[model samples]
Target chain A: MTEPPFRRVVVIGAGLMGTSVALALRRFGVEVLLEDADPGNLRVAVSLGAGVPVTPGDAPRAEQADLVVVGVPPAALGTVIADALARFPSAVVTDLGSVKAAALADTRAHAPAGAGLDRYVGGHPMAGSEQSGPLAARADLFDGRAWAVTPHADSRPDAVAAVERLARTCGALPVQLSPGEHDEAVALVSHLPQVASTVVAGLLTTAAEGHLVLAGQGLRDVTRIAGGDPDLWTQILSANAEPVARLLHEAADNLHRVAHTLEKRDAAEAGLADLRNSLERGATGVRRLPGKHGAQPEAFSAVPVLLPDQPGELARLFADVGAAGVNIEDVRIDHSPNTPAGLVELWVHQDTVPALLEALAHHGWDVHG
Target chain B: MTEPPFRRVVVIGAGLMGTSVALALRRFGVEVLLEDADPGNLRVAVSLGAGVPVTPGDAPRAEQADLVVVGVPPAALGTVIADALARFPSAVVTDLGSVKAAALADTRAHAPAGAGLDRYVGGHPMAGSEQSGPLAARADLFDGRAWAVTPHADSRPDAVAAVERLARTCGALPVQLSPGEHDEAVALVSHLPQVASTVVAGLLTTAAEGHLVLAGQGLRDVTRIAGGDPDLWTQILSANAEPVARLLHEAADNLHRVAHTLEKRDAAEAGLADLRNSLERGATGVRRLPGKHGAQPEAFSAVPVLLPDQPGELARLFADVGAAGVNIEDVRIDHSPNTPAGLVELWVHQDTVPALLEALAHHGWDVHG
Candidate 1:
């Protein structure tokens, strides 16, 4: 096997991201030392074979570490990162935080004068779950995900390279951006949608039980991310307050425009064109999202098949598709409890539709248009 | 095996909903006559075995129909329903439209004096897809879904029963509500989310391409519904203008409040509590949605297992899962192209988790928490 990216790495927080990083580094045969304020978290990380706990007696080992990954909560990111730099004077420092600018500013504020400020870079792996903590960590969590590596102006080239290497070692593609640019990008892609989803879901609290019972897949998808931990989100939002607030205000303005146009539509039916334009713009925007693994979504065609509700039906269907030598890009099962037949939509490359259709026909699977 | 609900049914406008309804009725040996202003849609529906095309030569069959289902665009619902009542005076007329109050009011205005207005009822099926037209239709589209039956004050009991029966014949649960109440309910559950999603996605048009590369599943889910046809949505929103505008205003106010709180947090950290409260409310509201087929979402647990990226691996996994005798409630596959292993999240009843874990371990599948 190739030599490990880092000779010795010390991870200062044994939470989800930190533990996952340690576990990923261990896969490369790199020596890892883990530490956390909470003994339970440290114990769990160690037991998961992520790394050996950096006990008091392991101080010398930590001092000799070449890289220190600080994976604390947003509120504590800067202070902990600054402390890591002071404790391990020669090691390059990095953090896993959602918001980059705030963390960089805080680190600069907390670091003593003449400290190695050039050693720090900010990284955010664009991957996570609604769940948190050590048990939720996985070595492959970042696979094929974009990891934003944000470097400050004062950051050294070698430190930025080390952070990029760290992202790659975790099975992620590293995209380099300045701290401010990274913050601005996430404000649009991540924070804006998060707040918009929250506001939509927040309105659901007033919905009658009968009304909510009418909710379908659309509402569920739009609000799924709203169920994230409130405490965590509060910290995240607070840390990136300026940019997120700007986007929220802009969104509010658009929503108000729609509402005003709708009210006018009720009065004279004059704003139908405006409503259509807004909806059209939305349609155009949604089509711009990159599909799984960076492919265009339209490049795949869905062939929905009706599967009988019985054991091994899905297995049999998949087996037939596999026999046809067609790769399934995605599968969506519309399972309805009241019916004996479920619709499964198999998405494959547009070119593979003919072969897949033949396979379904040969297997006697009912295919829907 | 049993008598079909309606002896002869006429479906006008062979679009997605109409074609799906005809296909569903055909499953029960019911005779259906399909009609559409567009010859292509009628031909496709007829060729799918949904029904026989109602050409000019089939006037006798159309007149003898016991039920008339108007499945035209929202703008034409009232005129078509009135025309159907005039053409087949004895037939009970119902419509598949998103907004109930507007359709009922328009029909009331268009019907001639003493035109048997009691035979008309408005229906809004709480199921749809982003795709439209006959080709996207499916026989089981409404399986285990709610179908709202809205009866105005003048409707007769038999007519109401006929509409409810229609709902059942299409494999949906019939929900009874007044025209006004159904409008209000859907304004909250459907139209509100649609507009919210549209607004969020509309902003994406202004985002930088690099920023969009940072998008993840959350943005995708929140914007998926925004991809629905703009013309169709314009009509749906226009018809439900009053209720939808009211809810949109409320949502806009809430978004503005959150934005203000976030802005305040940046200055003094004073409104963090307010922000948290909003997020908390959103979390609580999202949890209120009923799971698949009305089951509580919390009743299921997700078991994520890593599968090797190879053809037939999915079939093998499903076969193993079937051998364990646990019914998989849902399956979500996170297939990253760059990875050698993909993660499949199988949702099952919480009580079956231990059994599933045992089966997975025995099969040497790598399970992730």
Candidate 2:
């Protein structure tokens, strides 16, 4: 096999991210020493074949590790990172934390003077689920996802390289940025949306049950991220307080402006133009996002098909589409309760539509449009 | 095959919703005469087999239509409904519009004295796409979706029944509500989320290009609806101003509160609890949404499997799973550009997981978790 990214690595937490990292590294034949404060998490990760549990007797192995990864909770990131830097003096130390600059500041405040602070870097794999803990961890959790590597001014070049290498070894693309820039970027892309979704979902709590029965896919998509762990998000938002709070204020102001516009729209039709302009800006902003693998979203067209609510229908559908040699760029299934049939939207490059349609028709599949 | 729900139907606007209704009606062998101010849209809908074009010679057919469905832009709903009531004097009139109360009020104000106002009802199929116009029309657009059949105080019981029959005939569940209650319900479920998504997406206008490259699925989901037609949304929001504005202000207050809590978090750790509580409320609200078929979301377990980025792999995977006699409730494919592989998450009932796992392993499919 190819040489491992590192000879030996020590992971300080055995939670979802930690265990997943360990499992990914193990795939590359790296020797990983796993440790967690909770014995239960450690045992679960070990049973999953993520890594061998680190014993007190493995002090030398810990010290000799070429890389040390601290994958703890947001509240504990700095302390664990500092501890790892000091413990594995010869190794590069990195962390998995959402907020970068705060973790760096905390590390600087906690690390002992003359310790290898230059060997530290920060990382956040832009991939996770609503579910948490070791049982939810998977070796491919980071596959084809963005892994941000945020390096501070004093971070050593070799240390930054080591973190990037770790990202690649885990099947992720490392996007490099400074800690401050990383914080600002995530504030716009992650934290602000989190709060917006949270506020929208929080309002749903007051809605009558009969009203919520009218809920559709749009509301579900808008609120899905709001279902994330409260304590964890609280820690993350707190760590990135300044930037996130600024965006939240901006968003709130925009919402209030919309409300005022709607309120005035009846008296003057011109206010409708202002409302339309605001929505137009949102449409333009949505267009700015890089589509899958950086392609433009227009590169694909979605063909929705109606599928019978049965075991083998989807299998047959896929088999027919495959026989046509059409590659499905993506698939989205919309199934509501008590519906005898579900809608599956197959996204493919526009150029392949005719082939897909022919194959679908040949197989007697119900193409919606 | 079976008797049509109505002997004859006239659709007044051949846009997305209107044409979709016409197409759905055509499936039941109903005689449909479609009209549109835009010749291009009318031609396209007619070419797609949605319905026959209404020529000047077809005036008698339209006047004789048993049902008149006004599927126009939000701003035109009122005038058209009033006009349809006058034109098809003996026919029951219904409309496909998002907001209900304003449409009813508009029709009431515009209808000629002694006209058939009692024959009017309002309907909204709670299913749509960001894309618009006749080219996007589909016969199954409202299949298995909630179609709110809202009636004003003056609406005849037979009129309400006719509208609900239209909904059922289009393969949708007809939900009954008063016009005012429908507005309030949509304000919470649809309008609120639309503005929240728009406001959040609106902020992305000022984001740096590099920052936008870091965007992930969470941001995408949160902003998807913001890509909808601004003119249409502006009209929808304005027509339902009171309730939407109220909800907007509530959401804004929540956002401001979260921002304040975050700002005070560094000064006092107690502020973190407030933040956590806010997030917890969001999580609880999300849980209140009825899952597939109105079931709880937890009824299905998601099994994520890695897929190679090549034709036929998905077919092989689905074929393998189907051979195991397992029913797939839903499928979500997450594929990023430049990635050599994708992740397909198959949501199945919990009891079928073992058989799925066994089939996956036997077929050499890579299961993520």
Candidate 3:
């Protein structure tokens, strides 16, 4: 096995992010020590082979470790980083905090005079699920994901390199940004959407039962993120309050204008124009999003294939497509409740659509254009 | 072959919905006559076997048909239904208008004294795609979907039955509602979500490039409907303006409160509480949505299987799962952009999870919990 970049690493929190980091490092043949305020969490992480838990009688792992990762919640980030810095005088320290600006500020305010501020780098991995805790942790959690690293001007080049190496070793692509820039970016791409989904979905709580029966894919797609953990989101939002508030205020203004224009009979034409502009702008924005394989969004043709609602049917369909040598770009299954059949929409490159349709049809599959 | 309920069906407006309706009816051996202001659309529908086009010299098919279906836009519904009713004096007339109240009123005002208001039933099928036009029409578009029917008290029983029969014949479940109630219901469940998605997604047009790189499934799901045609959505929203405006105003207020609390440093505790309540309410609302098979959401354990991004890997995996005798409840593929591997998350019944895991592992597939 190759020599790991960090000989010994210490993880300060044994939660999902922390445990996953430890597990990833362990997969790279590095020794990892797990520490958590809650003994139960520490035990779980240790049992899962994330790392060896630091016992009370053990030597101070922080002082001996080459690197320490602070993976606690935003509220506790400052104190944890401060304690880790004071304890590990020679080790490089980094944090996996969602909001970097506040954590960096708090760490700067609390760091001891002799403690190396330059040794600290801030990281926010753009990966997570609705689930939490060590049980939800996986070694490959960060595989192929974007890990944003925010370095201060005074930060040591060696410290930044260490963090980047860690990210790369875990198969994550590191993108560098300043703390404020990181906060603003996440506020737009992540925080704003979370809040919008929650607010819109909240309306459904009081919706008439009959109205909900009419709900379709549009509502389902719009509100899927509303199922995120409320407590965790509250902490995240609070840490990034300024940027989030600014965006929310702007959204509110737009919404108010739409409602006002729509309510006025004389403004019908204006209302139509405003609504159309918003939608068109949305179309342009969504189109810019990176498609599969990190390429620009390409226009793909959808060939809908009818499949029996049975185990292995999807496998059979995929096998036939593979036999035809067609690369399926994306797939969406639209299954009606109480139906024995589903329409699996296979999105393929435009050039390959004709061949795919012919191949599937020859294989006795019902392919709908 | 079984005789279709309607011997001859006249479909006006040969667009996506109209063409799909004709196609579905044609599947049951009904003779469908297609009419559209755009001859290009009419020709395309004819080529797709959606229906036969009515030639200029031919006697108007509407006058001889047993049913006259007006599948026009909200703005054109009034004129088309009026003309169809006048031409087909002995046939039942119904319209597939997204908004029923305004169209019903318009038709009522335009109908001649001898024309029967009782023959008209307003309809809006709760099924569609982002793609429109005759080329996007599918025979099974309405299979197992809801078709909302709005009828006035003056509507004749035979007329209501005719509409219901048409919906059933097209493989849609007919749901009866008043014109006013239908508008209110769609405003909450459909129109409001569509507008919210557009406004939220519109913000991305001004977002920095680096920010969009971090966009995830949440942003994708929340903004999917924002890709809809602006002209079509404008008409849908305007026709249901009253209820949509009411809902938008309420959403704006909620957004303002959350922003205010988040902005005030002194209100951190209160802000967290408010945010949590909003998220919790959203959770409650989303929970009430019908799950697969139109039933309450079932708790399914996700079994993440690591698959190589090769042509036949999915098929092979499915074949293995089939051999294991496990029924996959649902599946979501979370593939990282540009990665050569993907994690296909297979949702299965809790009881079958262990068996599925064992079988997959035994079959040499990488299974992750």
Candidate 4:
């Protein structure tokens, strides 16, 4: 069947998401109008071809607009959406905020008494980088990513459908989720992860910072998320404090158990086992994520092969695995620092592990048990 | 200056390290003789060009071996080193165990009940992956990496020099450290990292395991070290429990504080600033890691740029940056799970950030504020 339609679209904010929505909509043959209070942002959007910039001076043109996408900051979101609704009463409205519950509550607060309310559909495109501003916007920015929509009780079926169509046009799969459920999920996946990474990174500055000089890939991986932008993350964590606080509290309780185990016992086996089990469960939770570009199915196995640490050993192993007619879903190598002569670990697909072992062993490779 | 002669090198315990040392020594035109309890391992070593594997049946050309390298498990290190000394008189011996402090202490227990113990030097190569067995042996595993030699007060200067020369011949830099100091440093840099990763991975597996599906790059990073061989790590953590425990306790304390700060805080500017500062410090700490290939100079500059999530965006960005004559030292990207959009943080020379920023800005890119 032919595509439905991508008609006149208005993206308020002209910041990262707004500009992205406008640029993405352009690919679908929709005429996009990007608006922002910041003059520089509007100019940047125009330069990036997100759309010709729009302002209150040209607000009259939205009379024929079919869709309105909100991408303003969480605090200022209500006023912007209300203004958009007041100007274009018939346009279907949705938001692209991280916190859906608070945004919905704010949107509810701004609706006029029984007027221009049915056109509003509370929505959040669960997408964005820490870096913001109009210049950071990109076409196809949400391709194959999730867009969670949480409609209000009073929202019309037509409004929700129109918003769904808009989301589809922007290359995101529309997933219906309750605002509260969405917040809790992100608290675990997004919010808790950022905070955990920060604390781990902080540990490097302890009694002897000199040891951090030898910080290897494992430490780097554990603390990678800690390098995000602080100002915007401040806004996000603040907005979702209630749920994030609950998640962190849960993590702290578990961490306390770990600390007591390590300090009181010698082996700390029981405590460490509990922690290990929990982390395995966490890893299981995360493995359910769709692969990049939404192209592959869920992956679970971690195949490991012993390797010698030589200049071309890694490259050879990968090439060896590739020649085995098996695709490596992903790979991770372990670099242990306590050997007189270095060894390496190659993690691949579990099914591929047997074949990889056979192929490499035939090549005179020294794979271990 | 001509190096002091280390002619007949004896490698005790013909396992992975022993076999690899045999191979490496052969490359240097040194006559090598290896010994292992397992006859099969010695055969494998002989087949792998690790020199003629000598067993107890044929007492190793004892007095001929100028340097005897002990390659045994940490659990048996003391006994192994002492046995080699008792069997071969006048051999400058060194053990290649993970923890030098514990190994030195254990060897001290079985030391010849007399003076002139200056022939033994404690050594460990700060390289290798988490895999054990003779099949994991490599010829050039220590190339370009640092080897820490922890010599006790009783060790002879000539013995230390000989080991340093051996490390150099193996293409490694020799860093001298006391046994206790080396153990503590490794606990922080190596052992603590693995434990932190395992603990973090445990956090992902609570409740019904749908969260595992979402284990994107962030969680992968946090838990990467978890998949390591738990048994080998157990021996290591047990040997260095004091420092690893200390570091983990410090991390747990900080995590608890961060969790507390996120609890039921008011929406005031002051409260927001505290959270922002905490995250900012995390960013700074992560940035303090050593650069690629162990660049002794740590500090590097980064330029943040936004790119469209399309095939050509990466190529376009690289072309633009390269066309400006700027050399990129490294690149780090923020992987956003919910969106195709990501932030690209490029590390370049300190002086190149401004020029790259100017070029990118001139080309209408949005660098995050």
- Using Cα atoms, each model's DockQ against the true complex is 0.32, 0.32, 0.29, 0.24
> lDDT tens digits, residues A1-369, model 3?
678878999999988899889989988889898889876567556756777877666556546999999999888999899888888888899999889999988997898777889899999888776667775777889987788989998899999999999899887889999999999989988898888888888998877758777787888888888877788888889889999999999988888888887888455476678777877887777776665634634668788887654433555677789999999887664435543345668889889988998899898988764
Candidate 3 residue-wise lDDT, B40-60, digit = tens: 567557756777777766555
RMSD in angstroms between candidate 1 and the native structure over all alpha carbons: 9.2
Q: Residue by residue across A279-322, what tens digits does model 1's lDDT show?
A: 99999889887766346667899998876644335556777899
Q: Deviation in angstroms for B129 in model 3? A: 2.8
Task: For candidate 2, list the clashing residue pairs, or say none.
Answer: A292-B337, A293-B337, A336-B293, A337-B292, A337-B293, A338-B293
Best-to-worst order by TM-score is 2, 1, 3, 4
- Provide the lDDT at B252 for model 1: 85
Q: How close is candidate 2 to the true structure, as a TM-score?
A: 0.83
Candidate 1 residue-wise lDDT, B239-333, digit = tens: 89888998888888888898889877756655998999999999888887877634667789999887664433555677788999998887664
lDDT of each: 0.86, 0.86, 0.82, 0.69
Off by over 4 Å in 1: A2-8, A22-32, A40-52, A266-270, A292-369, B47-49, B266-269, B292-294, B297-369
* Alpha carbon lDDT at B220, candidate 4: 55
Please provide TM-scores computed only on chain A for all of the candidate models, following their numbering. Answer: 0.82, 0.83, 0.80, 0.76
Question: Candidate 3's error at B185, in angstroms?
Answer: 1.6
Query: Rank order by DockQ, top first?
Result: 1, 2, 3, 4
User: On a 0 to 1 DockQ scale, where is model 1?
Assistant: 0.32
TM-score of 4: 0.70
Which has the greatest TM-score?
A: 2
Clashes of each: 0, 6, 2, 26
Clashing pairs in 1: none
